[model samples]
Target: MNYTDEEICTQYGDRPKDNRGAVSPPIYQTSLFTFDTFEAFTHAQLYERENYVYTRGVNPTTELLEEKLALLERGEKCKCFGSGMGAISSVFFSLLKSGDHVLFVNNIYGPTQQLLEHLQNFNIEHSFSNGDVESDIKPHTKLIYVESPGTMLMKVVDLRKISTIAKKHGIYTAIDNTWATPIFQKPITLGFDLSIHSLTKYIGGHSDVVGGAVVGTHELIDRIFTYGFQLNGSVLSPQDASLIIRGLRTLPLRMKQHQDNCLRVIQYLTTKEEVLKINHPSQWKGGAFSFIDDQMTGYSGLLSIELKEGGFKKVAAFINQLSIFKIGVSWGGYESLVNSPIKENNELELIEQGIGTGIIRFSIGLEGSDLVIADLEKGFQALHSIKS
Candidate 1:
């Protein structure tokens, strides 16, 4: 039988076997596991993905987390890692050979792009999908990587169309599904081959832990484990896995408040003279093709805004005046965060990405909308002071 995301999050992994019938799963914090006999030990080592002989291959705590994640993404298997890049790198190394090409769609994570650029040294090639994704495909293109409702511009492309295109050319498809999480968009159901996520964001919920995961069929995930995962030597600690497990129980509730607070902030920004354009999936007014409602159940609190004025000095002054919203490099926590791509000397690059020189990204937190709005008022006042 099928279960709701909340049910799966809260009670899917109900173990009644041990630990005084503890309601919360305990961390099996040891680095190694033992068996009754040499025969059993040798047998378990052969199927390390399932049986735990060493923590490097599997731990009871981290394995439990992986089970829930695989079910959440509607995939047959999953592998947890130390960070989001770990999962991405695993997919790349496991699937692509030295001569293969990669096609990236929408605005990918900056570090992901950097990793691909570094792969150029090893003879791997990558191209960003500018206008037509299908047109950018080369004979050697083996993967189509994407980030929908992209973190920066918030532009979303049609996933089904992209998946169909990739399948036609026999290319594997993967999406950085961190922004939507499994609560909003499930890529496998939409016909993609793999779905990857950064658990450090919404999954960890409190910004306390860093983790990553990839969900797909057993065949594909096994390939990643054999070639990319074990060799890369990235492991999600049992303690961190336990923390993420705690975060999972309240994901639905936190997501609702996040979207609610973000909507209020968007509403307030619409009335401000200092605001030029607001970029969000839920707030799309049809200028660009953002068909989110049909694909995703909801949007995260993250969104970007273009200021009426331009340049880094102006935007920096506004960010500095904010009392509640901290200027942080990461998001997906209880406290709100603000960041921007408008650097002091990257105007040409910003223009090329279709970004204004005064764009700012906000990750609205669980704090009441009133407080967030009040903090934003302070930022606006700073801009006004600069004008005077």
Candidate 2:
């Protein structure tokens, strides 16, 4: 029987059958599969092509995660990878070529920008879509890559409008939808050709595993499945895929608590005497960062806050003083994390986004809201002492 996407996800992503009686899906942890006969081997490998040749090509555990991811993104196909960068780089290499110009959004993930630089070093031309301008698209532009609510600073881009412009210019649109998970935003439904995710974040939920996924039209996925994935070979391990699958079961629940905590935290920050700015989408004036649109209902666990004075040094002091939030590089895990760009030479660039040296990015966790708030308040008290 054919199952609906939601039913398929519930059954396969989380709610497995009680035949074995285990609630969680078991990790296959296998590297290879065998066939019964020579004819069967040929059928699986060459003629019929129904068998798995290598773990790099496919795994049952990874396949389960891919199926759920395709359902989550409302796409026909999905590809899993070792990390978010793997997925993104595969998409780039699959779709782009030398001399093909790319219109990429500014304020994207740091690693992505680094990748683009490396691509440029390899002769692929790229242009930054620094401001909201469609006139920048050139005839050679082949792809428009965007990451809405990007990085430590939250900056939203009009995906639909950009899609229209890209279509007119014959450019394919792709997005790093990590900030707005599928539970809140579906980039495919909003006109993106491909949507990529760092499943290590919200999808993995606990931040125990590192993985990424690309979900999109069957045609685009087919190319990646055949060309990008086959050659570069950054496939997600079967064990990691199991972690993401298990995490999917609790995504909705965890995201709700994350939003609740962020709302309270952002609201409190807005009222703080020392806070200079808050970059949460809830505070945006109906631009790309505004979550009032139909594309998003709830915010993710991440949000950024700027202090009135002191830059990264004070932000670092506050972080060192914090008891609950750990200073880390990544977010979207069960625990909280905070970081800033205070030490970087790009401090002025971040400051341009209303983020100061004292600006601190917070990833809310499943911890009790009251306790989280008290911990943050103590950090703020420390910040005040630094200023005094």
Candidate 3:
């Protein structure tokens, strides 16, 4: 039977079978696998089979996760990496050469900016645009890299428009879909060449693993699997792979709770006197809300809140006073966490551009909305308390 996306998500997204019917995927944590002979190892490597000749190239545990990811993204193939940056860097290295031009959104995750820095040193040319349809894309642009509803800043770009433009120019299109996750948005369905993820976030769902993935057409993925992954030696560990697989099973349930709690917290913040701006996509129809409405079925656990009266001191105070939310760097775990986005990070361009100064990001967890809102209330109270 042809299943709806939701049905497929239930059946395949969280397959209920164990190796011995144990009800959970086993963690195959071996570094090497035995081959029948040298010829078998050669064939496995040459043919790109899942039979593990080496863990750095492929592992059975990681391969299963990749298969599930390919299904989720609706791509012909997928590959996993040690970290999100690894996945991103592999894609870039595989596609671009010296003097090739890539058009990119400036508002992506900080490490993507770092990747471009290395690319520039390697003699690749690039253009930075707003990633909106209105922006001008020059001829000879070999690729268009997009990050939708950029997490740290909460800016949404039109992926479909950019994808259409890239196709017209014969330019490949890639997106960082970490914030939206497959449950919320599927960039491949919108005609992107590749959809990448920092699976450490929502896919892992528990802040336990640092892994990344790339999904694309079979031809492109085959090339990446061989050249980008096999050569780079940054494959996901079998243990981390198993953790991510477990996390994926609970993603839909966790997401529903995350959204419910985040919406309540956002509502509370929006009505507060200390708030200057609230940057949740569900706030309207065409602005930020429009992007979420048009592109995503539901918002993830992430959101950014901007306060007018608070600088670093207020942000720090708020973070310190939180009872339920923890202070940490990454999000999309079972626990709620808050961090300063506009703080002084080593990323100088981001700091100078006012991207990381008066903003605080919240990764709402699977907590009770009323309790989470109460915790936020205490934070606001502390912020005002210090000022008073």
Candidate 4:
């Protein structure tokens, strides 16, 4: 049954009356579950998902979190991992043979590119696309991976169109839906094969946990679970799983506030002369908004802005002057963050991805819009002084 994201967020992972009728699910923090007999052990081994045998293979706490995530993504199953990279690597290792090729759509996560580079030792090939799925596909192309409202640039891809092309080519489609979250966009509903999330972000919500998940068909997820997840030992701790559960309960509310604050910040940014360009789905032209409006329920608190004129020194000055927004990596927490694609004395990867030198990526937190805007104004003043 199709449930609203708000309803699913609150209702999907309710524990039964077996645990003294507790409202919150208890953490099953154990290495293994003991079986009463050999027959029972054999049954658990045969049907791993139905019964927990080992914490490495399955844990009740993690399983409950997985079930809730699967429902949120509108998928048949989901498997959580120790980190976002773990989830992504498991998918690639499970599905791709030595000679298989993957076509990555625009502006994918930086670590994903590194992962593909490492996969070259195993004879896997990958290429970046200009968003033309049909033209980019080669005979050996087995998968099409995309990140919509992509990292740094906030570029949006047409998922339905990409999924349709993948279907025609008999290839699987996967997406890093971390930006939109399941509350905003469900790629599976639009025909994508898999939807992955870095649960450390919005799903975990509090910036307290580090984890990832892949949501897809029972068969596909099971293959990843067996071949990649277990073998790699990228298991989510029961404590972390419990924290994510608490985060899920308030996800809908958090996302709403995020969207509202993002809109306000974007509006404020438009009036700043130092702001050369804004990269956001809401600001796109040429029918981009039509797809965004139709596919996504809301936008998250992430956007990129290019300074009017600056090099690395000016960029550093601007970042240093910000008081409320902390200078750090990995956003989607309760605190605002500011990061530059071009770090001091560092080689430019963002430039290769078409991001500019003075571009700053903002992950607006649950702060008041007025206060956040004021902080940015001071940052701009610092940039002005540096430019002088």
Candidate 5:
């Protein structure tokens, strides 16, 4: 009667009973579905949110992916979008009205902050807070948006604290759960109102697909579906949906391998003189990160390291020296990647972020741990030569 997480990933919501019993879920590639009768067509339009009307509103392929994602996150409803920002924008446009305020916690994604700045044109406002939730809460605050193990530093905010505060004040809370995925952290179980993920990352496993999803209660999700999803028309294609489903089938196996490789890399970094600090959940040393184990079962391979001393040229030198790791952006793939938030012209912003120019974020891939560590050793040598 009981099924395991791997079973849920591979088996749940996928039954061969339909579609001529094809072992793989067939892609319903049509733009719209037709009803046999006009009366049936009207009925479908009336219940467009639940019925198969058009691909813009719903598609069997995307819907299957949505159902699986909702189940994975333990949420009631779900919506898929063309990109992660599309999902995020829909959530913002659907839930927020004129003059409403949003409270951003910890280090949020750069593009997300840019989107919030854009919203200011419509009279919506936001405030970024480290941990002082009490000071930031305003009378017009409508939502508390946060990212755990966020951005480069991997700063984690207390989800329980955020949810409880939001509920006490009648505010909705949402989290970017892409880093942890549903495999490690279920925001709904932690009392968050909405959980968002960039399926282009780990859920897709491969870098071939670019999609996003939002999961939460039926009421909120339906509202987003109407305004943010259907009306705005950022829809996920059936081809992408099928691709994401294939990725989900091996999520358990891929995630475990990523974690194993990351931990090994972290251990090696801790022993190096060039590494000033390792920014990842497992390496967190203080009580501030104590709830990590309680909230998450595991972590992703994404992490950042601060060099003992460096600037833009030094960091660039280190990254340029790496062979196995490719210098790039947008992680959560089978290939290792390297990037830096610190740039030559962003000194003031870096100071505001409280990070140095020496930070390098790494996205460890399925490659062996020994290969990753050996490349990093070369990168450190490049860092040292910069002094000359």
Candidate 6:
């Protein structure tokens, strides 16, 4: 049955027998489950998803999380993993062969680029495109991967256009939908083959847990489950799965607040003289918004800002002076976080991706808009104090 996002959260994982009539799902923490007889054991082995024989293969708690995530993303099934990269690597390893090629949209996650480079050792080939999906296709291309409101720069791509192109060549399409989440964007409904998420981020809704999920057809997910997930051994813990389930219950409310806070932050950012550019979908003009604008219901807390003038020293000063916003790596939690795209040795890579050294990415949190704005004001004050 088709359920709204809010309803899906409250009711999707509710099983009276599984939870012993408790409203919340209980964590199946045991490593292994016992069967009454040899025939029962054989049935368990044969129908792995239907019956849980081992925690690594499947656990009741983790399976509940998977079911909810699959429904949220409008996919047939979902497989949870220990981390975001775990789910992503499983997809690549399961679907692509030694001779296959992959075409990636520009400004993907750094680790993803590194993963593609590592795949070269096994004779896999990959190419990057700056939104030119049609022109980038190669004869050996088996997959097309994209991240809308892409990593660092927040560049929005036309997913439908990419999906159409992939379909012409009989290729699969996968997207990292962590930024938008299922509440705002439904990639599978828009013709994507798979939708992936870093459940540690917005889906987890807290800083405590780390996990990932891949949502797609039963056939594809089963293949990944049997071949890649089992072999990689990146199983999510039952405890963490339960936490994610708790997070799911509040996801819709949290996301709405995130959107509201972010829009307010962007409004304040526009008034700053030092703010040169804001990379967000809401700011996309003309034809750029024609496709994506309609599909996405709202934006998340993640956004990028390019300063008018700054180098590493000024950048360091700005980040150091901020009190409310923590200088951290990952975002999409309860607290606001800030980061610079440029690192000690990765300046060239940032430049190659069209991300400037002065650009700062902000992950707006649940903090009030006034407080977040004041914190940024102090950051900019520190930036201005430093000599260019």
Query: Tens-digit lDDT track for model 2 on 1-388?
Result: 4555446545755445633767777787888777778787776766221357678787777887888888877888899999999999999999988888888885678788888889988678887875764878877888999888777777777777788888777789999999878887888888889999999898898979999999998899878977778789887999888878878888877888899888888877777887888887767765444534866766887988877786666777788888899888889999988887778466787667545676788998888778788898888888766742
Error of 4 at 188 (Å): 0.4
Error of 1 at 279 (Å): 0.9
Which ranges in model 6 have alpha carbons more than 4 Å from their true place? 16-18, 344-349
Candidate 2 overall Cα lDDT vs. reference?
0.81
Which of 3 and 6 is ahead in lDDT? 6
Check candidate 4 and list the clashing pairs.
none
Misplaced by over 4 Å in model 4 are 285-289, 346-350
Better of 2 and 5 by lDDT: 5
lDDT of 5 by residue, 103-187 (tens): 9998889899999999999999999875789678999999999999788899887898789888999999999999989998998
Residue-wise C-alpha lDDT for candidate 1, range 67-181, written one tens digit per residue: 9999889989999999989999999999988999999999889999999999999999999887598999999999999999786888888898899999999999999998888
Residue-level lDDT of model 4, residues 1-388, one tens digit each, is: 7777777777666755777888887899898999889999998899886788998898989998998889889899999999999999999989999999999997889899999999999999999896567998999999999999798888898888899999999999999999999999999999999999999999999989999999999999989998889999899999999999899999999999988998999999999888899988878755555677667878899998998775789888988999999999998988899998786665366566577887988999998889999999888888867742
Model 1 RMSD, rounded to 1 decimal? 1.5
lDDT for 160 in candidate 4 is: 88
Question: Candidate 2: where are CA atoms >4 Å away?
Answer: 1-9, 13-23, 47-50, 285-292, 344-355
Top-down TM-score ranking = 5, 6, 1, 4, 2, 3
Q: Candidate 3 lDDT, tens digit per residue, 116-187?
A: 887889888776784354355665577888888775777776677777888877889999998888888899
Q: What TM-score would you give candidate 2 relative to the actual structure?
A: 0.92
Local accuracy by lDDT, each model: 0.90, 0.81, 0.80, 0.89, 0.90, 0.90
Minimum summed lDDT over a 10-residue window in model 4 is located at: 344-353
